[model samples]
Target: MNGALLTTWRLWDKIYYRCTRLCYVDQQNNNIFRVVIKKYGGKPLRSEQEVVVSPGDYYVKLHIHNCQLAHRLAGMTGEMRLGLAALKEVKTSLPALAKFVAEHPNADKITGVVGTTILYRGAQPLGFFVRDIDSPLVRWYKTFFFKLILSLCHPEGVARIYQKSDKLVAKRVFMSKRDLLERYLDDQPQT
Candidate 1:
């Protein structure tokens, strides 16, 4: 993002954070996730950890810090390096998130964690369950939003989106609390 765009995005991000009640799991600007407690909408979801999430159930909703992520990924070359860095960020984030959930006052009310992304491949092996977005409007909005972020963040910008348009569709990913705690809490150092 350029100077003006960057400023605008930062302003908007502030407003979005307030509006969504987003909480920073890691308490750092470079942290990958900002989350909010939200009630699940749409159809029921069965997570890999065997938790069933029904309508109105609460879960931690994740939002990627796109601008921070773009900054972290800036100047990197090669798709492999970028992919590996992103995976590392995800892995690095899990411990903090697990600690947050474990200590939350409402942790008992939370069914699990949920996020939507175009980058759904390889998530299953990491304990996430992928599903099609139930709402067409949501799907379209997420596609547009993520693509815009990608264009702004990617080194090649819009070209990369066009070249990989086929795989850019948005999907929902879910991870049960059981999976999150089992995979991250005991082994991960408290952050």
Candidate 2:
């Protein structure tokens, strides 16, 4: 990743940590958190007042603020793809999911929400929606034509496309060995 992307990822990491801590610490009440990015001296990024983080001038520093209980819940509502088919089947094995996530640096950075939901009123499958459609596309094609096609397709087609795209994303995100273990664990029946 480029410096700008790395910085953004790091900032997101800090936000995730703060949000999780807030949620864990105060489970009783509603918690909200604001993530702010501002140039130095309250100037815009294009302004001279902005502080450049690197000599190469890839990134700028920004101000961040959080409430007592940061909104970790906001993080918990996005699409995630687990490599293990079995785990994908169960859908509720959070510990297994967490363990799978812990194996990767970026994956571990993710908290709150994991896993994509296949919308359905009952047994009949309905559709799937990308939770964070604006989120950075981890894959090349996902950012370009493929994602556009998937988005514009019919509901049933969209679901199929999501399934295929998720498999590719899961492979990219998870370690093969760890993912296999998770898949095995997912296959086992819950007690």
Candidate 3:
């Protein structure tokens, strides 16, 4: 039963990778605009908008929004499932991003989430999170000495850990963003 579950998980991971690739390709050809509303109800607002937003930022916003909706729809179930989904999405997208970074030597920098946000030293962002600070994956990634040793022993375990980590981050971010937005809306005095 465990074997069957593992196999199903693996297949889902592959499908996720394919979907991410397609999304990346589509995003490459698309132009995204970030519009900031400076004024609401004829009053000048403090927020400033950027004409272009990075894919990483866009992904973060999408993830946060999804998390909020999922929470609303499934309540606890949404929280559980969405976290898993976010982790899977991030894991599947990372390799392609790494490859893109390698090929684009002159790109600015890539941003990814680790314990905090990590800059990829190029124009691509690799958003990831480690499940446990003491997990082998985190240790291996930080130390870089036991790459071969760790890879040989536990690839799936590492992936799962990172996935769980990302899910936690997503949940936190979703809650915080939702709370802030709610507060902002609440503070607006109705005329």
Candidate number achieving the greatest lDDT relative to the actual structure:
1
lDDT, candidate 2, 73-174, per-residue tens: 122222332113222332433334333334434442232221122221111121111232223553344444434433332233356566655533311111
TM-score, predicted candidate 3 vs. hidden true structure: 0.24
lDDT: which is higher, 1 or 3?
1
Residue ranges of candidate 2 with Cα displaced over 4 Å: 21-114, 117-183, 186-191
**lDDT of all predictions, in order shown?**
0.82, 0.29, 0.29
Model 3 lDDT tens row, 1-191:
13454456456645754665222311342212111111112111111332122233312222211221222223223335644544444434333333333333332332221121111112122222212233456444643422222222232435534554433221111111222233332332233
- By TM-score, the better pick of 1 and 3 is 1
RMSD of each candidate relative to the true structure: 2.0, 19.1, 18.8
Each candidate's TM vs. the true structure? 0.91, 0.19, 0.24
How many steric clashes between backbone atoms does each model show?
0, 1, 8
Model 1 off-target regions past 4 Å?
Answer: 1-4, 48-51
> Which regions of candidate 3 are displaced past 4 Å?
1-77, 107-191
Error of 3 at 37 (Å): 27
